[model samples]
Target: MTRSIYSFFICIIFLTAYSCKDNPKHTDDIAESPEQQLKQRYSKLVTYPLDSTAFPRSVNLKTNNLKKVPSKDWTSGFFAGNLWQIYELTGDTAYKNKAKKWTAFIEKEKFNDRTHDMGFKVFNSFGKGLKIEDDQEYKDNILMSAKTLITRYNDTVGSIRSWDFNKKRWKFPVIIDNMMNLELLFEATKISGDSIFHNIAVKHANTTLKNHFRPNNSTWHVLDYDPENGDIRMRVTHQGINDDSSWARGQAWGIYGFTMAYRYTKDQRYLDQAKATAAFFLDHPHLPEDGIPYWDFDAPNIPDEPRDVSAGAIVASALTELYAYTDNEYYLNYSKKVIHTIKSSDYILDKDIEYPFILDHSSGDWSKRSEMDEPIVYGDYYFLETLLRLKDLK
Candidate 1:
C-alpha cells in the first residue's frame, strides 16, 4: 500500500512536469527572447535582393493592362529605397552598391512629368537612396525628381497636382498614400533651400486634413479636384468598394503618413488625425482576436474575405511610431499586443523558412487582382520593417 501511494504521487508529478514543459505560458518555445522572436520573423526577409534581376526592374504596365500604370522610371528608385533599408539593417555595402546602380537606372529614365506617386515610387526611393549613399549623381537625380514634383504644384490650389492623365476631368487628385512621400518634399526643401517643396507639402497635408479624412478618422483613398478652379469635385476610394467604404491598406497609409507629418512638422492637428485614425482602426468590431485587420473593413457580404496581415504589419509599424511620438504607455502596450498577436497568429508563416514569403493573407489586387490571397513582395517588406522596428524598441 505504501509503494502504491508513492508510485501514484510520482506519476502525478511526472505528468505535471510534462504538461508545464509542453504548454508553456509563452506562445512559441523557440522564441524565448525578443531578439530570437525578431530573427524568427525577419531573418528570411534579409535574403531577398531588391535588384532588377531578382524582381522586375519596372512596373509591367503592358502586361497588367491597367488604365493607369506606374512608370518604369520609379522601379529602380523603388529598389534603391529597399536597398537603403537593407543597408541600414545589415550594414552591407553590396546593398549600397545595388542602390547606386538602381539610382543610375532611375536617372537614365528620368521623366519631367509630375505625378501623384512621385513621392512613393520615386522620392522615397532615390531621395532616401541619396541620404543613405551620399552619391552626387543620386543627389542630382533626386533633385530632378523633386523639381518635377514641385513644378506640379499649383499656386492657385495650394496643392500639387496628383494625376494628369485625366487632363480635362480630374485636377488635383491627391491621395492618403502621398502622405508617406512628403518626406521627399521636405528633404528637398532642406537640401535645396527651396521653400516651394515645403510649402507644397504643407498645403497638400492641410487639404488632406480638411477634405480627405472622414469624421471617423478613416480616409478616402483618392481626393479629386479641379486644378484650374481649385474646387473639390469628387471624393473616391481607389482600393475600397466605393467612396464611402474603408480599405485596410488605405487606413494603414493614413496612420503612418499622418504620424510622419506630425514628426516632420510637429503639428498638433496631424497628431490628432493620426490618433483618431488609429483609434478607429483598432476599434473596428471585425478586427480578429489577433488584432489583424481584414483587407477591406467594408469588403461586402462575403462568407470569408481575406485578412491582410501585411496591412496589420504596416499598422503595427505605424503604431510603434505613434507610441514613440506620444510616449503614451497605452499606445506602447497596445503596440506590444499587436506585435504579440502577429507573432502568434498563423498569418505569419514562421515555420516555412524555405519559402520566400513571410506573412500570408496578402491581397495584391482587389479589382482584377491576381494574387488575391497570396504572398506579395510589399507584404514581406512591411513585415520585415515591423520586426526591425521592434528590434529598435528593444
Candidate 2:
C-alpha cells in the first residue's frame, strides 16, 4: 500500500508536467501582451470598491491594503486621470463613466489655492477630461485651476512656490517638479485666448531654466529664493538622498516638464534644456540595465538601492515626446526599453492584487520612509501616458 501511494503521487506529478508541456493554450505558456494586461486590469478597476470618503492613492505595503487619500492630497487627481486615459486608450464607456464620477470629486480643488499642486490636483483630472470631450465645464474648471495656480507664482522669483510648509527652512521654495504645472497655464491660454497665462508659463519655464540646473545639467531638486529681491537663497532638496545628489524622479520631472514646455513655446532653449536633462539621466552611470533608476542617482549603495519605477515611467513618456521632435532613435529605443521592462512581471502588479495600482516598486521619498517600494498613483498615471504615446507613435 505504501509503494502504491508513492507511485500514485509520482504519476500525478508526471502527468501534470506532460500536460503543461503539450498545452500551448496554458496561461503560463503564453505571456500576456502589455496592452491586454492593462485593458483587463482597467476592466476590473472600474468596479473596484471605493471608500466613499476618498480616492485611491497607494497601497500600504505594511498592511497590504488600499490607501484612500482625501481630496486635499497632492495625488488626488491622478486616479481620475488614470480612468480618463483608460477611456481614451480603449474607447470604453464603462471607464468614461467611472472617470466622470471620480473627476467630480476633484472639481472643488480648482479653488483650493493653498498649495502649488493645483496642476497636479486639477489639471491632471479636469485637463485629462477636456482631452476626451470639449466640455465647457471642464474647460472652465481648468481655466480656474490655472488662475488659482498662478496665485502661487511670485513675480520676484519668476516661479511658482512649491510648498507652504517648512517655511523656516525655505523662504520661497520652487521645486523642479513645478516645471510640470506650466502645462495648465499653457492650456488656459489656448482655451481663453488670454496672453496672461502664456506669459506666465514662459516666465516660469525661463526662470527654472536659469536657476534650477547645475553646471553639469543635473537639476537641483529645490531652490529657495530670497522672495524679496528675486535672488536665489539656496539650492537644496527635501526628498532626494542629499542636498547635492540627483533625485531620480526630480530629474525625470525636469525631462517631462521641459519637453512639454518646448512643445508649446517652440523655444529652442526649452528644447535644449530638455535634451541636456535627458542626456544627464540616460547617460547616468548608476541607471540600471533595465532602464529603471535607483531612488537617487548618487545613492551610496549602487545595485542594492531601491528602484523608482515612477521615474522610469516618467522618462518613457517624456522620451517618446522628445523622439517626435528630434527623430532620435536613441531616445525612442530607450523609451521602448523602459516600457518593455515596466511591462514585465517584476514591475507590473500581480493579477490577484486587491488594489487598482498597475505598477509596483516605486519609491516615493526614501528619506522620509514614505511610500517606499510601494505602488504610487503617479507611477500608474505616467505608465498609462507612455502607453498612449507609444500607441500614437506606432
Candidate 3:
C-alpha cells in the first residue's frame, strides 16, 4: 500500500511539472484567447537578459540569433513601445519599469533630423509612455521631435522628403510611409498650439492623397517630386515587387494615416480616402484568406510567397480604429479574424526560443532580401496595438 501511494505521488509530480511549463497563469491550455497567449509569451520574454546599449529588432534566421539595433536604427522604438503596451494590458509594474528603461534610450532621437522616422522612433516610444502617465519630459521630447520632423518637408513639393540618399536618381523623394509620420505633427500642434506643425501635416497629407495613390487607391512606395516646381518627376518603388505594384505595408500605412487624419480633422475627404484604400487592401485578389498579405500584392508567386505579418498587424490595428469611427462590423470582424489567425502557434514564436520577438514571418524588404520570413520588432509592436484596440473595442 505504501508503494502504491509513492507511485501515485510521483505521477502527480510529473503532471504538475508539465503544467508549470505553460506558466501558472494559463486560462485554457488548449483554447486560450490570443491576448492570454500573448501575455504568457511576454511573461517569458520579459525575463531575457538583454544589454541596454542596443534594442532588440529581429531574429536573423541564417544565424538563428537575436538582432539588436542602436538608437539610430528606424526600428529602435518598437521594442520599448511593445513593453509599454504590454504594461498597459497586463498592469504589470515590472513591464512598466522595463518600458521606461528602454524608452530612455530613445530620447536622443528627438534631435535626429537626418531621418524622416521621428514619429516612428520618438513618438512610438515617448509618445506611448506619455499615454500611460503624463510626463513633462515625454511631452517636451515629443514636441521637439515633431519640430525636427518638419525640417524634412518642402513647401514646393507639398510633402516631407523621405530619403536623402539616391539623390542622383531622384530630386525630392517622398514615400507613402511618410504619411504615418504626420501624427506627430498633429499631436505637437495640439500640445504646443503651433499652427506651423499642423499646416505642414495637412499639406503633406494632401500631397500624398493627391499623388501617392493610384486610381484604385493602391499607394506607390515612392514618389519623386521636382523640388522647384512641385511636379511629380517619377513614380517608383523601393520595396514593392516593382514600380507599378502595390506594396502591402505601404497600403497599410495609407489606411492608417488617412484614418488618423480623419480622426483629428473630421474631414470627409480623409475618411473617404481611408475607406477606399482600406477596400483596396481588403478586396485585393492576392490577399491571403487569413488577412495577412504577401510582401507585394502583385508578387508572381501567389500561394508560395512569404507573408508580411507586420502589415497584417498594422491593418488589424487600423481597422479597429476605423470600426470605432464608422461603427462598421466588417472592419471589426476582419480585425478579429486577423487576431485569431496570427495568435496561433504557427505565427507566435515558440516558448523555448530566446529571441524577444512575439510573432514570426514578417517580411520587411524582400527586394533587398532583408528580414525575410523572420520575427521583426514592428510586427510585435502593432500586434500589441491591435490587441489593445480590440480589447477596448469589445
Candidate 4:
C-alpha cells in the first residue's frame, strides 16, 4: 500500500508540472506593450513582396496564400498607404522606400476615370505621399485624379455613379461608399482654391444624407437616383446581407465620412449626422462585446457570423477624430477599446509567421463568397491609421 501511494503522488507531481508548462502565468505572456506589439507586427512586413506588381488584397492565414491584385483594382492604393503609414509610425527608411515605389504605380490611375474609387485609390496613395513627403508631383496627381473623378458626376443625379456593372437592373446607382470619395474633392478645393470641387462634394453629401439613411439613421448601401430629376428611385444593398439590414462597413463609411465632412466644413448638421449614425452603431444590441463588428449587424447568424476587421478599424479611426472634435470621452474610450481588442491574439496575426498582412478575419463581399474570413490590405491600412491616430492622442 505504501508503494502504491508513492507512485500515485509521483504521477500527481508530473501532471502538475505539465499543467504549469501548458499555462503560463507570467504577465508578459498575458499582455504586450502597445509599442512593442506594433513594432513586432510591422517588422514582418519588410519582406512582403514589395515589388511593382504586388498589391496584396487578402491572405489565407492557415495556408499562407496571398491574393495579389493589379493596379487598376480599387484596393491597390491601400497597401501603398499602409507602407507610408508604417514609415510614419516607425521612421523606417525601408518602408519609406517601399512606399515611394508602390505609390508610383498608382500614378497611372490619375487618368482612369471609369470608377468612383478615385479617392480610395489616389487619395490613399498620393494623398498620403503628399502629407508625408510633400512631393509636388503627388499633389498634382491628387488634383488630377479629383478632376477625373468629378467627371462621373451627373448634374441631374446630384451624386457620382458607384458601379456600372448592374446597369440592366439599376439606373444611376449612388452608394453610401461614395461618401468616402468626397475627401479627395474637398482636399482639391483646399489645394487649388477651386470652389467647384467643394460644391460638388457638398451636393453629393447632402443628397446622400437626404436619401441614403433609413428612419433609424442606418444607411442603405446603395441608392438609385433618377438621372433626369435627381429624385430617389430606390434604395438597395449590394454587399450587405439584404436590402433592409445595416451593412457593417456601409454604416462605418457613413459615420467616418460625415465626421470628416464636419472636420473640413465645420458644419453642425454634419456633426449631428455623424453623432446619430455613431449612436446607431454603438447602441446596437448586436455589436460584439470585443468591439469588433460582424460583417453585417443584422446578419441572421449572430455568434457564428464572420467579423469584418476593416469596418472596425475604420470606425475606430473615425471615433478618434470624433472625440477630438466633440471632446467626448465615450468616443475616445470606445475607440481605445476597439484598438486594444484588435491587438488581442484572435485578431492580430502571429508574430513569427510571414503573414503579408496585419489584422485577420476581415469579410470582403461575403454574399459573393469571396475573401471571407481573410486578412485584407484595406484592413491593414486602416489598422495602421488607427494606431497612428492613437499614438498621436498619447
Q: Residue 291 lDDT in model 4?
A: 85
lDDT against the true structure, each candidate? 0.64, 0.83, 0.83, 0.82
Clashing pairs in 2: none
What digit string (tens of lDDT, one per residue) describes model 1 on residues 1-394? 1222222322232342222222333343433343334334344444544344344321222244212222353332444566566665556676566656655555533455645566666665677676665666666666667777777777666667666666565666877777876777777777778787777888878877888888888999888877678788888876677779888889998998888888878999999999999888988887776777778889875338887776877787788778887877655555556556554555555444444455556765576665556555566556555545655664
lDDT of 4 by residue, 279-329 (tens): 999889999888889999999998899999889889988998998888898
Indicate whether candidate 1 or candidate 3 has the larger lDDT: 3
Prediction 4 global C-alpha lDDT? 0.82
Q: Local error of candidate 4 at 365, Å? A: 0.1
lDDT by residue (tens digit), candidate 2, 300-359: 987898899999999999999999999998888787677667644468776567688878
Off by over 4 Å in 2: 1-37, 50-52
User: In angstroms, how far off is 322's CA in candidate 3?
Assistant: 0.6
TM-score attained by model 2: 0.90
Candidate 2 lDDT score relative to the true structure: 0.83
Q: Compute each candidate's TM-score over C-alphas.
A: 0.77, 0.90, 0.90, 0.90
Candidate 2: deviation at residue 276, Å? 0.5
Query: lDDT value for candidate 3?
Result: 0.83
lDDT of 1: 0.64
> What stretches of model 4 exceed 4 Å from their correct place?
1-40, 62-64
